[model samples]
Target: MIIVDPSSGTSPDRIESFSLESDHSIIVTSLEHHVWQELEQEIVCSLKRLQCPRLLDSTVLLLHKLITNIVRTMHRHAFQQAIEDDLNIDIVSKDNVFDELLQNELNTHGDRNIEQFCRKNHFQVTLTFPEKTDTLIRIEYPESCDSSAYLDSKLAKAIGFTLLKQTDTITPAYYCATVVRDIAQHHPHLEQAGHSELLLPDDESDKVLAVFCKLNYGIIVFSSAGDILSISPAILNNLKLEISPTSAHTLTGIIPGHFYNDVLWGLALQSQGGLFENYRIRIRLPHDDSLSILFNISGYRHHDMTIHTLWQIVSLDHKATHTLAEGSILNEARVHNITRNYVPQLVEQKAREIVRLGGNALLNEECRLAVLFCDIAGFTSYVENNEKEESVIHTLNMILGRITKAVRQHAGIIDKFMGDCVMALFREPHKAILAALEIHKHSYDFNNLRMRAGKDLLLLRIGIHWGKVVIGNIGSSDRLDWTTIGDVVNTAARLEKNCCPGAILISETLYEITAHMDHPEIRFSKPFYLKLKGKRNKQAVRYVQTTSQTLLHDIFTTHHAKG
Candidate 1:
């Protein structure tokens, strides 16, 4: 550890004689060097034993600028003269001031750490261990009005270069700010709840932020004070342009109608083959601010569905109102029960309706990737032989609920569940692997909890594979289901069959993706070959082992206390 000593009339020669012990050690002194003319020479002499040429080069220029600015800003000449006169020193030098600043940075108060110093002083301080490529930087004043505006102006100027015409297009930076502003304004109750300020609140903000950051997702947040917070690591390995949420071409999901109408019209529309395809509707206002009644007639079958939902936003207030207004033709409908099994599908369909209303036409591109297939091992025997139907169903639901929670925590979308089997798709390979990891980890905890309750523990076998697969509407003309299909899906199921109870079996594709990820608790067995059904080549499968010390264990302790 570096020891920072505040200058208390220590001579320049004595300060120079102080030994630098460790590579991590540096003696920061606050001596007002009046006699020493060359600051670089003094630092070099002290750091001679330390073979840090790069540090010297990097710090010399930055430190010089900082020290010179500080000297000029603080009018150190007069203060130095008074101090030198009192201490009987010859003159003040640059080395003295530089050492003082460095010392101050390394100081430790009783309970106040270095972070407190940087925060209190509003400094952008970064400490790097060049050899290890490790860096820890405390960026202070991001919450301050001044710093936020400065960052915004900087980001705006950077984004301005990409935009052809300011009026025609919103730059990536501006779009990020706009989205952040919208979230903040409309969702004031949603606080910034993550390791970073830029993260948007999801169901579980911390987990979401961790997964997003790990996957190299860039985030930008807008403060209520109109300041922008953006963080993008310089080196993002294999990160694609489409992964960024702020990208103009990136797709977004939305829900337009109120709770009741949203479920009914959305479900009815999906039932009549209008979920993914374009649909038209007309909006006739019921009252000024009471509610907006709209009618959506299916485009595929021309089946009419009525929706009544409260409108919280007006056309004049929203800049993208024209987009919403142009595509949608509105009609009035009575509100009724919309809640049913297919509610989320309606929510997703409502997102499409917003696009129909003329918001930037939502992209119809299919996200193709891996899906994890999971099922409880020996579930049929347990259900038929031992447990009652209701009890078995309850246990199955509990297992599904626990697994789904883990899957969603890692940002995996649940495709569907057949009996005790779960089909979840991750559009990205990383998400798929992470979801598998979470599932395996959670299953152990769930089983342990069941064991404690004197209930037979249900073992889950998960199979994950990655490949191109179409993700869009499926099913008959009368009913549409958003799902995925491909050879990868089949392989995932086959891999699950090979998996043992309480194990996660993954295809070669999944193992490859998660090979080097830092998951200490997860143990992977050596890859084995399996002759899968209808497959010419033998498939490679590996099982993921988990224990009680997992995410599910923590969640159970935190949430299942009452139960």
Candidate 2:
């Protein structure tokens, strides 16, 4: 089991030394110059110590396999150099300002005016790649002068799969002329080539290095059986794409081949929760297809032997089923079956039920409840000024998720989202008040982060009221909406309008529930009179501040206790 460790180093010097110290029979493959000789000796010493029998546990193979796959995918030239020099495998990109590099090059070396810039900077451009391979190509102008800007631009451009090359030849004063001249003489073929065949060596030794180098951005897929299905190096180093070992049992269709059934069984066991937590299995693939058999192996990050073993499990073509009888990989079809069989059909059934309850559920006599309302201040103006519709929506969704979770944590049911506003109701004043306070606290937390980023602040205005309200389904016969009505909701809206940003304001009725609870944590202000709309007498109201330490603790403690 020869394990490849890409993290070890890819330069030619490191790789050559690694082979020298390996079992003598393993043989010294090829040697090229990707890195200097100083670090090459260190790798040789480390390899000698590691070559002993059983020096590295079997688990290390997983990372080795992953690295091997990556090296196999590298540019042929990079592979050759590593093989020649015994290089260290460093996958991290050295250039941080790739975006700036690309942009600067674009403006300066663009086809429209490249001649002038090249002439003044003593630069020459070459485009020698065959038409079949050179789909998109550009030569950067050396006169861009700004190192950071140029580096950033180049990095950004190279982020996606791209054939990239850089040389000091662009400048008149070559930094290392002697070294460049040697490479040009010895490897004259690569000097004038673009998308050179060097990335894909035909020989076995060269091919191994080439493949590993290409593994830079690809996803290495392994089956449950610990067999490799595909190594997609193109996507390996990308920042935008996220690749991880996600469970494939939930995936649709027959699971692909080249995986392990044992690992799948292990994952299946884990999913079973407390009942099967300690379960173990010694069965092989296919023959022992009982759902009772499962495993509990550790997962690995690199392409090692363990991961290859896992690949075998997922590779089962006709293994098990969703049924408890046939311990299958609980594939997508099974998940859909369960969802369709038990879950509610909210889109079609909500209206009919709303009508059956009443004209307006919240307005019903038995529906006395507390209502909470919150609105994002300055939302309308912000939307009008910002042209980035997607960014705005993404941020809004994040805020809503946080607020919604807080409300649900306190047993509050969301009614509707009005623009950036949220309407919720609770069965008891305690839950309602707690939910409102949590919303304020979470909103403050979210806005604080936004403030640091120089983004617009999301200030939440909250209002709560508790009173007799009618709760029923309201709307036309064909489209009944479950909602609440009555003076309680109206009063809550009034309270919201009265409060400032970042404040959770509640009416007098809601506060009455906790006034005598004798919780030292609950902080409040004395009752104040407000001339509310549609009321003759000045209504007595007290605003409760959501920031009280006691109130915060009460919400967390209640939820934690239940969990």
Top candidate, metric TM-score: 1
- Which residue runs does candidate 2 get wrong by more than 4 Å? 1-365, 546-563
Off by over 4 Å in 1: 1-341, 344-368, 386-390, 452-454, 546-563
Model 2 is weakest, by summed lDDT over 10 consecutive residues, at 27-36
lDDT digits (tens) for residues 1-563 of candidate 2: 11123344453212322332233212111111111121223223332433322212221222122222222222222323333344444432234453354346434433223223232323322111112222221222222221311122232222211323354664453211110012232344544545644443458678765764554322334554544455442322121222442222222122333123434434433443312122122223332334222222233333332232121122122344222222333454577687753332322243343343222232212234678888876678778766474378887888888878888898777777777987787755677767776776787667557656656666777888876565455688777665667788888988887776666677766676545445555567788888877778776776665345444434433433353
Compared with the true structure, what per-residue lDDT tens digits does model 1 show for residues 283-308?
32222323332222222212333322
Candidate 1: how large is its RMSD?
25.9
Which candidate leads the pack in lDDT?
A: 1
- Residue 28, candidate 1: Cα error in Å is 53
